[model samples]
Target chain A: MLVGTASVEALAASAPTISAWREQAVELRGVTCLQVTAEMRRAAREAVLPPALHPTIPAAISIQAWRVRDGDLGAFDFVCCRVSCRSGVRARGFTTGACASTERASSGLAGIFGFPTRTATIDFRQGYDGADLRVEVKGKTILALGATSPEPMGPDDVQYTSTLNLAHTPNGLRLVQVEAHHLASKIDRLTAHLDSFDGEAFGDARLRPYHVVSASIASEDISLPGVRFVCRPDELAFTGTEPVSRA
Target chain B: MKFGIFFELSTPRPFSRENEWRVYHNALEQCRLADELGFDHVWAVEHHFLEEYSHSSSPEVFLSAVAAQTRRIRLGHGAVVCVPEMNHPIRVAERAAALDIISGGRLELGTARSSTWTELGGFGVNPDDTKITWEEFVRVLPQMWMSEEFEWRGKSFSMPARNVLPKPLQDPHPPLWVTVTSPGTELDAARRGLGCLGVSAAGYEEQERRTKEYHRVIQQCEPVGGVVNDQVHTMNFLYCHEDYRVARDIGVPMVTAFNVANAHLYWTREAFPTRAYQTLGNAGAAMKAKSRPADDPSAAKGLPEGVGVGDPEHLIATIKRWESIGVTGINFLLNAMEMVPQEQVLESLRLFAREVMPKFRDPGDRSRVYAPTTVPGFVSDPTC
Candidate 1:
């Protein structure tokens, strides 16, 4: 009588699945999944704003990460990210437009520009090339253009832009490789990105630690080369010397 | 005024697929009949992985099926092994609550920390930690019942705040009981404020003394788990026939065989090095020794001391003595190890109900005659 009449299928379907990209791969040593997510959200909110923006933007984010310690090769970590602008405007009369975008990027440069290029699409495109890189903002600039003006201005006329990046880390990227091997199929998209491009528009954008990403390795192969990544989903710590900044 | 039958669905000695199903269906049929016959309760034992002695591993499943069929007879778990290793406390609470709703609150939760080595070792349970785990379970069960979002960080198990659903139909909870086979356990049950289910097959004098001790300890009991105080119930074997000699000839051996089989299964743990004491070799030898035909008449003498195996008149007399000794109710062990035919056991139950039960039907007349005046110093109250 202690066992309920509820079917296993009903229970399985109703339980929540991992949601939120910012929270995808952060790990906590001795904590429940819920606690880990909460901690990740706190850190995302405290993250420094891009230098070009005049004022700090208040934002919220979440992530979901999973690692396979054993069994068939698959995603080591999958994450989703979201951000909302609290304040800032281009002009007094222009209507504010909110845009959302989703992208799948690799944790490794080999994965990012190797065989297949990971694509992130936006609403507008304005080419801005740095010293050796051509960076394109696909959507309307954060600042609104005056309706009466004949030409549009850039950063001088804008407040801030809303952008979200969803990518796999080295550990997470490894998992994708293992999963490709496990499924017995070649990875056409990521492989093409890795083989075709070098330091083109992103000029060793691959060199940027933030730009560098990795996939999760199969849990069974936790000891494989460059695949033994143990990052707490709850704890956010910066590693490399370069600080995070906007282009 | 509750009357019920305990089923292990035991199929000892002559094992047959037909006989096994026969015993099982008979118990289900008995529950239906007991409901029709106006019996107040029908209980089953929960055991795991034991072969012939017990096949009723999942009592909840069996009882749920029983619930579907019976309308009036309350279904009871004589004792649920409340160790975390075997079952989680939350699972136990949730399951019990669901059963109560299914059975219209006719579920009685009788719990205990298991004593046998076979059950303990097979599940990797530590003997010394049994009491602690049981106490923790008892402590947490009530919170699970009362709170919408229950959370606890105990020594053994911990969980975050979450509402545990499908609470029991009974207000507060079902009547909780604990099984006790020894004198110390009887007193312990009283101090914990749980119902004492005395299962030892002891003489009338010993039963009287233990019952008295239970009442004495219960008077000052500050409840440990949920309830404020405890209730007490005793167990006895029952078999009735038209002729005293006929009943003695058939029923005595069956009861004797059950006792020997149980003792051998559990007591042999003292000899083995392994945590699991169940050795098929030892159990088989014990059964063989017990079933051996006596060469001399003196070897197969009078009823094995404590067993109640006789005609209607004798059974009634035995029950009266138990009542006089201050025991609340007697759980009759009707069909044990399939020693007797299903039909014969049913006949015994019917005859006993017709001839013996009516005598003790009055609620006012059944109250304990001697109330204990004070609590003994050795009996410490259980702390939740």
Candidate 2:
């Protein structure tokens, strides 16, 4: 992790030792965000983590993008994002496999937490500050880090939240449904975003309803008028100073 | 096709007294510039308690100021709310007549039934009854303008036989128009022979369907004004630069801000639960919002595939699409939410005039600058 963390069990004798750990809080308008961390004090207790995975810090992060378009998934129209942070810290966009793979999910520690739940709720306000707005994604869903290659899920391959809704069919099939908010339009913009399995070890057993979410605000110059920049992820750092501004 | 400018007079947060004045005067300056740029007309909305969405509550006064500053560009109420509760029909007639006279008959009288709960409730206008009231108001308005001593006993207002003084300079009245936001309103505008002043930022497909419906229906309808002003004037955003990317970069945020602010005023049964706005904001406008990406942080924000917010070539192609759809004119919302600076707005207008206007503007012979003197070829002697 970017910043070191004390062991939970080591704090007191009453608690048992655990190698893997994760924590997050995502209420954007309330100025809160998800912070994930995984600590390993002893190799014996940290067996849950995938092999060859290590923690990374979110030292500097850049504003990647925030949008909610119509999608085929049942949880369509929720705000979601791919927040790229320094030192290889990628936020949520995990699939059922990543959430189950505690080792790989916690491998990239120290990132943001977000709620990509079934419910489509977004309360966003912009221009309260000179160039800043507030976003709130209340409610709950699962959080995890997904690695495109089993190479310890870096920041770029991870996602902050998921907004695609997965429906449990009568035949026990969890099929992706059209987005809830803009149902008529989302059907056209749907893509199979969950195909980034990367030969992981877990079956699709951890598929809770999938939901996507994103928080976007436009400012008039002083407030991030957000001129469109086709700058690649690397170029973002050159074009803009990676501000630690959360929420 | 013709072009014009429309305003909601939106300003940014931390709105001070200074910003309000600046918004008004900047609009006047823009109107003056629009006249200089040969834009056909300039229109402003009449709204109340709309916070930052629209501040132009008194269109007559605003148009008066605009008229005094500009010489050629026509001024319109883009429209005036015609509910009797908000404005007595007689008063609307008088005010419109006065403004028309002041502007030397260069007035387009656009009328509307209140569309937002904030305004309908503020004026205590009944949504279900507003349509009837507006129909009565609009029908009677023309009579009030044309009749020597008008007398009317209607559901909304009853006036004794008294002259509606200061009759409009136009033979019958300024060309009539109505805000066509709801689905059937365009047909209603056609049936009444009024121009469709569409508030919805409809897409090309929708506009084409509606325009076709209007043109076909209006041909078989009776006239509402002195003569049929069968036209379609739709709303759109305008931002032009040599570079298409540069134009969108500036236009997108402004367009998004305008849409968001507009949505706030649109009453949904869930948010407001009011009959006004038909328990929903303009259906077409809402669909327009739905058609657009809810949040597009990228610079490609403002106009879509066929919108008047890009390079001259892009705008020309976009306008041709609208023209092919049978749209007669486009009213460009030059600035909103203070997203684009005043200087940027001026530059955009100038660029559009230079690059886009000439393609569509007819180079026909000029009409008379002034009507002939009362006694043709008569010379007045200084000695007399």
**Chain A accuracy as TM-score for every candidate:** 0.18, 0.21
The residue ranges of model 2 lying beyond 4 angstroms of the native Cα positions read A1-247, B266-279, B283-303, B365-384
User: What local lDDT score does residue A103 receive in model 2, on the 0 to 100 scale?
Assistant: 25
Supply DockQ values for each candidate: 0.01, 0.02
Q: Write one digit per residue (lDDT tens) for candidate 1, span A116-219.
A: 22222322211121001111235412211111111222211111112212123332211111101122011110000011111122211121111111111111
Candidate 1 lDDT tens digits, B195-285: 7776555566667788899889888775644444355666667777878777778887777556544643322122112222222222332
DockQ of 1: 0.01
Worst 10 residues of 1 chain A by lDDT: A31-40
Indicate the TM-score of model 2. 0.58
The interface RMSD for candidate 1 is: 35.0
The sequence of per-residue lDDT tens digits that candidate 2 reaches over residues B1-384 is 778999888766567999899999999999999998888879999988676778888878899999999888888876888888889888888898898898989888898887664576556665557788888877787777767767777788887787887888876678889888877789999897888998878876778889999999988876655557788999888999888788888887677667656644523221121233342455335345335444432225445655567888878887887898899889999988777888989999999988788898655511212121122222222111
For candidate 2, give fnat to 2 decimals.
Answer: 0.00
